[model samples]
Target: MRLIAGVDIGNSTTEVCIGEIDNLGNVTFPASASCPTTGTKGTVVNVHGIKSALKEAMAKIGKDVSDISLIRLNEAAPVIGDTAMETLTETVITDSSMIGHNPSTPAGAGQAVGKLIGFQNLGSARQNEPYILVVPARYSYEDIASVVNRINGMINIEGIILQADEAVLVYNRLDKKIPVIDEVKQIDKVPDGEIAAIEVALEGQGVRMLSNPYGIATLLNLDAEQTRKVTPIAKSLVGKRSAVVIKTPAGNVKENVLPAGEIYLSGEKDISVNLDEGAEKIMKTVADAGKINDITGQSGTNVGNMFERIKTGMSDLGTVEKSDIHITDILAVDTLAPVKISGALAGETCLEKAVGVAAMVKTHHLPMEKIAESLRQDLGTDVVVAGVEAIMAGLGAVTTPGTKLPLAILDMGGGSTDAAIINENGEISMVHQAGAGELVSMLIQTELGLEDRHMAEQIKRYPLAKVESLFHMRLENGQMTFVEDSIDPRFYGRVVLLSENGLIRMEKDIPMEKIVQVRRDAKRKVFVTNAFRALKTVAPDGNLKNVSNVVLVGGSAEDFEIPEMLLEEFANYRIVCGRGNIRGCEGPRNAVATGLVLSYVGEMK
Candidate 1:
């Protein structure tokens, strides 16, 4: 009997499979293990992760790394994916006129318009004159509430903006409640003695009056031209719980359509599509240009800077010449990114329409041989680069029990999505495309305004639930479950991810339904779209209708909803699509590693 081990080094993980082959050439797998990859794929740094995984798998079989007769590694092509967001338009305010933010808790529920006055000057206000109080953090919430109560009959206080986060506390202590907008970090920037309007929506609602441009015109008595200029301010205030719009003589808001620039596609023919036109048009232009050999962006523009950053990053990671690295594929998705308004109080952010692009970098060579030689010397065992990644994955996919001869496989991984088809004659065709799990996570993070990458990844990888009570939780599907033990208070009344470690509470104020919708939509925009793109490239005659069986293999295939989404999409074409079970044991994983060993044993026979 001869012992052999196969290793697959990927962008995000390293997998190994151990097998024993008899003299008759029959093979049986003994053990398998996987761990996070040490560094960039196709580099010598991967040997650390490879050795760790090998030691783990060997331990499972009561053997050591030295006992393996030979080791096989997939010929991994280094794929680097980089993403950037280009906002089509930006909101610039010349003066501090608008404070539009969705504070977690605001006070009161109404609209009021009056002259702005400092809290220290409230004592000198003329009786029966309407004024809005601007209070600083030096004054306590109790003192503010007490002073407002004392001046109730003498001064008409329409609203109040506090520099501290005491809106709810002050509102509750008041004998007469008024609109309170707190957490204004730059309260001193408020245009004192200017006419201002404040609007606070009730619970579970957004501001209605201030979010409308005509409504602001009615409150501030502005003409058609002034209303047109303030329209961008209103647009930024939409969906906000509380907003304040002040009218100043020199205040102006300009909605600038930024020069996002054009993408130049060098293929069978050259084509240029401007990013300002949006993602759909850009992608359509890309499709019209067949087989992209190189992609470039307009110089001195947002996309140009972004592409330069990507090129530099990839060149450094792969240690290749910058000129040799060509962007061969691009995936663009429409998204609304949170952009901070130019001049606004309270650090306000507005959702701006952006085109998020994921670019794929391909080079002529990578130092995979260096990695193999390093491993050979360290382990004192024979190691060789076996075969292409997609072809090997296709070979391992056929080992699935119910699969047939002519098979197709989609290796949905972190950095890129790869597809391969094997015919009965053993001929293989493969294609690698940009954008996969990482892009999906980027979309989730940008759309939901999440600052933590781990939270966004969790949102992408698992299902979500809303803790309805201490004992019962409502899932994304609207089903409720009861637990015997008391749940953690931190998770109470919050949308939590149902992850392997347990209920992880999401700190954002997003609703469960919206989170679920964003997650599924992101998956559809990336994976489902890439599935069709990859399958068409590898299918006969570039037609998905001609393809029959498709097995999803890789880490992303194990996601709770991605496979189901693809299965539903492929169903229309009568394609049998599902996650692959490698050797009828490993589910949607270790396919490339297993295929490396299988291909070696076949050569021996």
Candidate 2:
């Protein structure tokens, strides 16, 4: 018989499952064990911590490191999203330069004579001609409106050319029956008080007599060479996505293009994928695999970086060499806005900032080759990484098999909240966001001004029991315990941290009731709020009606009151909510690790 050991290294714990495979290809679970993960969820590798877990797990199955024949590892991906970029508008100070003109729609274009006011005086100014409004593209609609209103009385306002959306609104409000084109390519640098042409297409109305530069030349009685000048402005409006041509009676407009290039990633195989059409497809492909064991740079996540850091730490400590470390499997879901990045350069859209933020919110999984490898590396001997959605699906596969599409999974971990949606076709959508158990602990610490993070964590995790008078209490194991007579009333609701001598007390004489209230409130804000938000974000089409089953997983899911709290909040949707029954024994906490083993088996097949 061949034995396969599935290891899952998580952020908080390491879980190992030993299974035996026979010639028929059936796998049977033999033994399983769990221990605290060596390092911070995804950050460091503690060789000693991992060794302890491995020893304990192996001992359960009466097997040593050499009993396993093959090993698989998961890949890690880190991503960042939801970054805000603020740009200050209306902050340019420069000498008036350039001319810009836009006409909504023209009927046979012609040049009009005009003088530029703001920058026209720099050159020759024609006092006896109509003036055109030259607006820059960078200005906001309000700013453009203000400028137009300010020059309304002073200038003829023959046409209002602008850089922003104001042009459309301004043109709509024009009193005269003048032709207007919406978007003008370049308006800032039009020459002042010069003879220029504005062109407009006449669908069937033919060319307007006023639109013809020659007509203007006839009216002004200009020479043939001078009449040719307005032709350029008419030509500029052609083929533009949206353009407005104002027959500038006097000024000329010119257009120019800017230089830009795309950046690509260095030292790796480059792949180009269009984000607009490809994001959902790619996400679906990754999700449908039921389980993704290893994804290198292809998927970005917070856990990926955590595993890399642990690997580096292990190598530095001489516990394991870099080559010995192998990432067998990795599960990462993009919790970012739908922004795409191409090559190595910033995306033209808001994707750059999203990528930056996703990089900060990453997670990963790693598997050692053998028991000695784990012992030497000082990492979690048992490691499993799976998307929260996949875990929920596995649970649903066991509990409610013939359900509808798009089942939801709310994974309330210590550091962050994760939510995933699995559809009937096995397509999955997942999201990770800040605010979970750790956030609750932080709130408690801050509100109560406690210095011990451990104390805060304990307070957030367990129920409180106040020491009432010096009465004898029965322990869970039927042991009798007696408290001291001189205990403060503040310790009435607080649990006793038994020491070598006597019961411990908090530094501050804060009431236990207040602490319990604060703790509960913190959990409500961080976990409950985050769970709802994450669920809404991951559901297909942002509709909750599609999700009928929500399986809770992760350490936080084990909280006695948390599951009920979520059930109450999500009751409106007629959804069935409960913890995952991993292997029909372990609770939701082992879902990831168990799923990792199942994923490994599937990949081998």
Off by over 4 Å in 1: 94-96, 102-107, 123-129, 163-177, 183-191, 202-204, 248-257
TM-score of 1: 0.94
**Candidates' C-alpha lDDT:** 0.88, 0.48
Q: For this target, which candidate reaches the highest TM-score against the unseen true structure?
A: 1
Model 2 segments beyond 4 Å from truth? 41-48, 76-406, 472-507
Give all TM-scores, in the order shown: 0.94, 0.47
The Cα error of candidate 2 at residue 70, in Å, is 3.3
Question: On a 0 to 100 scale, what is the lDDT of residue 286 in model 2?
Answer: 35
Deviation in Å, model 2, residue 346 alpha carbon? 53
Candidate 1 structure quality by residue, lDDT tens digits, 248-281: 8763554554478888999988999988888778
Evaluate model 2: give its TM-score. Answer: 0.47
lDDT for model 1 comes to: 0.88
